[model samples]
Target: MRGNILQKSFIALQWKTSFTSQYLVAPTQVIKSMNVGNIRFIADAKNSGSKLEATVFQDDHHRDGRWWNISTEWKVACSFVVAVTSFFLNARYERIQVQKEIKLNRIQSQIKDLYGPLYGNRLVSDTSYRAVMKSHKGLKKYLSEARRKKDAEMIHCWRSYVWNVLYPLDKAAVDLILNNAHLIAQGEFPKEFEQLLMHAARMEFVMESWKNDDGALESAKRFDDDDYLEVSNASGLIFRTQILTHVKQKYDTLRDEQKQILLDISSDKQADDILAKIYQKVTHQDL
Candidate 1:
């Protein structure tokens, strides 16, 4: 009886050991991850407090979702900031460019008033005119350099008027000038046309000496330097010649009424009217 009781107690002890070990030991291969529940909890959780704390430990999806939201908000804010900054910068740039163009046009008008497009005739003090002309030319070069550096859109604004003025002698511009002159001088040249004629004649007379072969070569050579290349070069002469010649031809072809207007424009000495007429004669486009 004693031996049977001892044997039974030993059997019970073995079963308890086996059961405890089985409870502690994990399966050889994992059927599902323990973290899967935590992941689902964060993904589907709607409660803010539980999501904020418990979801913090979840996979990148939850963490990244939050980060993405914050990032998106920042990106939107940054976009708005950039847009406002661009608006002010563009406005300031436009204001500056417009002011520059206006200043240049004003200076050009003043120059016409002073010289009436004649080289020797002086209206303003030489110093004043020269100063203004220098400014105009300098500003033009500045704007051009800026455009070359990628500020073209800003500098040009609605149109390329700056580009047009800077390159007045370009083929297209020249064509425009000639065509305008023809129209303005169409029927009976205006007094403005007469003034244009006088100006053309004077220029022709002044440039006559440069037409001499010996003098031509010398004058051409003088234009080789940067300073002289602008207005004194052979190419410049040719360009001006074409313009003046066209104006003269147009003037000569004008009808009787146009001719009378030209005479009156010349004799009146009114700079504004004279220039307006000259502009019409030269470019056809209203200033």
Candidate 2:
């Protein structure tokens, strides 16, 4: 550095000496030309490669260059950290989204296909049974004394109302419960729901006993005690306790979960979009 600076200084001195000797007659013009030439020489020397060294010695661009390297490195590290963090966060976010969607789908199946129909069946069963029981002498008395004595009123009510109305409703409820056991929250389901199926099964045999007897009068017209089918396991279900209350509670809970999951999914989408923008700006890449 010292050698280079000294060489330029010597050249400047030669120019000054030449200006003094050669331009003595025309000092002003020669001095102007010499000054310009000397300045150009110094500039050329500085441009030759001394600029970087000079800048370093003067504590200028060297620090800037170092600081730029540091800045770029910092940005790279920041990008790396952000990339790693985003990778894990996005993975976990997708996992949670998958879980929420799975649960939401399950609830949808329950409400739309299973419990929804079962609940409607419950309403029909409860309303029809209560209405019929209200008008008649009640199911127990009608089946026991009235049915045994072959009472006209009981037989007419069975043929007209019970056989036509309640039978179909009960069959639907049983079929729903039987088919959709997978959606049950308690896995095995409440005994009441089981018992309802048992009741329906027995009632099916009782109603269809006419067909079993080849259309005979006693078997076709009446529910004979002799033709009672003993359903296995004695599973019992009460529509009110098992279906009405349980299904409502389950349906409401699932609906709430579904609503919350929808909100979470919306928020997660927003978060993912924001993260994608940040990642693009940081790493200069698309999601």
Candidate 3:
């Protein structure tokens, strides 16, 4: 009886030792290859005699592995969310900046138009005139020579300048003619004065049409094309010429007394002087 008990104790010790060795030394592939029955048998054997908790160790390892995988997945998710948020924020900022720049440019343009000529004349004191002359010295010299020679191209160039810059009809100038329409109709103004006013009004109409129909105001501000300048000048001249011719034809159909009134108005020295000063202001030149 004593021998059998000792032998049983020895066998139990060996079994425990074998189970511990297998659990500790088994590779993942070897553990995976074990059948459910084998695993259960090992677990039962380990539970029966061993004080070391093999099942507890395995449970702790599984929980730790699961926690590690969850941590990794959460970190990746957080990074992606932060990246998307930052991208949207940056895009929104850029859009706001662009809008601010556009508004600033518009305000600057309005300020320039209101005060530019008052600060410096384009033909005389402005830096832009010097810059243009410096950059196109040859062209300037050639144009001067051509003007002296009465070249047709030079004449056309000067005419373009006159229409585009000298005789440009702004709101103030347009208002002047529109407000004096009663005087024109009553023959209280000279035929020459009436024709000039008609020309200015028609040119204003043409400019407004171009601005509204062709969306040319923004392009005109750029001043990058000689062709556009030429077209604008020619268009202004043609419109004014047509209107003036019509007015003259109508005047010819008027009675002798009306014609005499127009002649008397034209011959008024004081009125002519006032008209000349107004023309000088509009054209920025000595008439």
Candidate 4:
């Protein structure tokens, strides 16, 4: 009987130790968890020396059931977050691409309809005019030495250039501005551009009057060789020729602002984050 008692005590101690070890390891997660009813059932017959009967786990089922529900809720929430992020990110990407296309189109229009023609015509006119000045000194000595055949020939060449070449090119530039004034960079027309139109108009009247007078040097005498040399390089014509330098600056600046060229572009983890960046990059800030 004493050996039997010793064996029962050892067995009870071992069972308690095992339960404690499982509780310590993962009390809430264990399938063999003990609840208050089982603890009481163990206590009621602690020393009665009866067979211990118990369920492996609690009957409540709330704790583990709630955990499974929480896990499933978290899964659904994460899926929703991913969906929302994808939707907005795609929208932001399209918006940025559209904005880029709009800007590129406007730059194209400015280059094609306005600055391109203006710059090209000015380049040709200025190049030819400068070549004449460099080659023949541009009707300067011709005025004093008009009695000589070579000087007369030089004056005739210069005069023909002023009428045929210079006037036509200036008129073409003026017409371009008139047709596309809406495309100017500023709110109002530039004074330089306006002066070009005025110069073209003034020279047109002079040419018409000279031709009407049968070309007896009528416009030349009245306008005077000295005035011709001075006013030919007037403020309007200055702006016209200076455009060879100015247009290039504006053109290249716009080109560098292009969507594909600027460095330091990056991707974002979220939609709104990158949307703000693109707005600042494409619209507000300089590229």
Candidate 5:
């Protein structure tokens, strides 16, 4: 009985070893089964280059008698396999979600006419907006030099549309000047006249360049400089004040056509002749 038990244990060990080896070489090969009483042994061919065999012997007459013999050729085989299902899932779904978010932000920025509206209008700030406008200086200079009609028309349209949006802010600057005109005109000489005159010219230039000429004219007409005289008694001392006075008088007294002609031409004999007379009368200065 003891000998039989020992034989079965040895057979089991041999079977396990054989199964492991066979799997290590070729995992797909089916195992063959051998039975002895209540015990079973399995084996498969591995590494076909070498012909090997294993066998187990049993005694039917002796109830407690058995012996086994096995060889490496019958061992099972296996190979390493890596399943990367999680890697594919992460790439196809998780990474795609991140890419989608970035694309959405980019589209939003383009639509808003800002480089990054979601980022608090970082690229659309006043400084950056002005910088972008300044970039068109090259294009404008090129078009002017080339004198291409199509390019000129395109440039004009771009400038017009830009002023449409920016003119309101420009008008606000004039309002600031109008508000502080008294303080500025009353202050020190040379400095005060320079500042006030610059303010006045800036206002006029903005109004002239604004999209709606009639509207800008009407808006500009709303500011009254009569009180400006109260700020300074030395109005005759500075040429800037005289120039501002000349411009105001022209705007106030001239017909629409005459005003347009004066604004349009840099040097017009007729327009200058008329302005010269007005300048002599209002400011008591020769043009």
Candidate 6:
């Protein structure tokens, strides 16, 4: 019975040692395999993270390039607008300057036409005199023909010549004759003196007839009744010429006493007043 008990105890101890070794060895192998799998998973996760970062960097680079292109286009558009506006403004300024020049040229041309060539020369020579006489004769012939034909248009056309040319000539002739009265008394006359006298007589007759004409008389009456005082250059010239002619004619007819009174008048205003009185006295009407 003691031998059987010793053998059974040894078998029990062997069984316990075998069971402990099996369990411990299986757990150690499983832990090693799980560690290897975990290491592979960590490596794969690192690779995926690197790929995502590269993609994000590429996207940022593309956006930057697009923004740079847009900025370049905006600059180009601004430059184009400035260029067009500058060109337009410069063209407009040039056009205005051209128009101003044209207007100035027109005004100069008008002035040259109206007051140059004949009247602009201060010294009158024999050639100028002949030219003037020829012009006057032609104008007179034209005027007479127009009147004979009762051509209203032709008469209207001659109005400027009648005032600017014929009237001025008449005034000049009257002045020459009055100034050279002593030479005339000595039986000396200027060149074309007879022609001037003839013209003067014709002008006097024409003026008298015109003043008495129905239309002229009515116009004169209306002009006299108006209170307007504006004086044109032409009208002022005519008035001055008439006053001088009247004064010269009256002076020639004055007595020695009246002439002495006129000579003694110191100021132009006093002389004009005395002459006006003399005119009233001689004409039996206020002058």
Q: How does each model score on TM-score?
A: 0.26, 0.65, 0.25, 0.58, 0.22, 0.25
Residue 53, candidate 4: Cα error in Å is 10
Candidate 4 wrong stretches, greater than 4 Å: 1-64, 136-155, 212-237, 259-287
Name the regions of candidate 6 deviating beyond 4 angstroms: 1-64, 117-287
- Give Cα-based local distance difference scores for all models: 0.40, 0.61, 0.45, 0.59, 0.40, 0.42
Model 2: residues with Cα > 4 Å off, grouped in runs: 1-59, 135-138, 141-150, 208-241, 272-287
lDDT of 1 by residue, 1-287 (tens): 43564355446544643575533232232122235213211121222222111122344444467788899999999989999998998699667657655644543442333212322221122233246346545434544544455443333331233122322223333333344443332245445434444444444443443344664412323322332222221122223333445444533333333445445445544754787788688786543
**TM-score of model 1 vs. true structure:** 0.26
Better of 4 and 6 by lDDT: 4
Q: In candidate 5, where is summed lDDT lowest over 10 consecutive residues?
A: 226-235
The number of the candidate with the highest lDDT is 2
Candidate 3, which ten residues in sequence have the lowest lDDT sum? 32-41
Could you arrange the candidates by lDDT from highest to lowest? 2, 4, 3, 6, 5, 1
Q: What lDDT tens digits, residue by residue, belong to model 2 across residues 1-287?
A: 54575466556655654565432221222211232112222221212332111111122344367788899999999989999998998799788889988987987888887778887788777777777767555555445655456554555445456566777887888888778888886576776686677777776655554343465324334555443322211113334545577767777787787788788889988987998888689786543
**TM-score-best of 3 and 5:** 3
For residues 162-236, write the lDDT of model 4, one tens digit per residue. Answer: 777888898888889889888776557776676677778877765554352565433333443443342332222
| Predicted candidate 3 versus true structure: per-residue lDDT over 1-287, tens digit per residue | 43564355446645765677744332222112223222111322233442232221122334467788899999999979989997998689567657655644543432233222212222232243344446446334645555455455554454454446545433333454455444243445445444555656656654553443465442333333342343343333323333334444433433343445445545654665897889689788634
| Candidate 1: worst-modelled 10 consecutive residues by lDDT | 47-56
Clashes of each: 11, 7, 0, 0, 10, 0
Can you tell me which runs of candidate 3 are displaced by over 4 Å?
1-15, 18-56, 59-61, 111-114, 122-287
Error of 2 at 134 (Å): 2.4
Which residue pairs clash in candidate 6? none
lDDT winner between 2 and 3, please give it: 2
User: Candidate 1 regions off by >4 Å?
Assistant: 1-68, 116-119, 122-287
Candidate achieving higher lDDT, 5 or 6: 6
Relative to the unseen true structure, what is the Cα RMSD of model 2? Answer: 8.5
Candidate with more favorable, higher TM-score: 5 or 6: 6
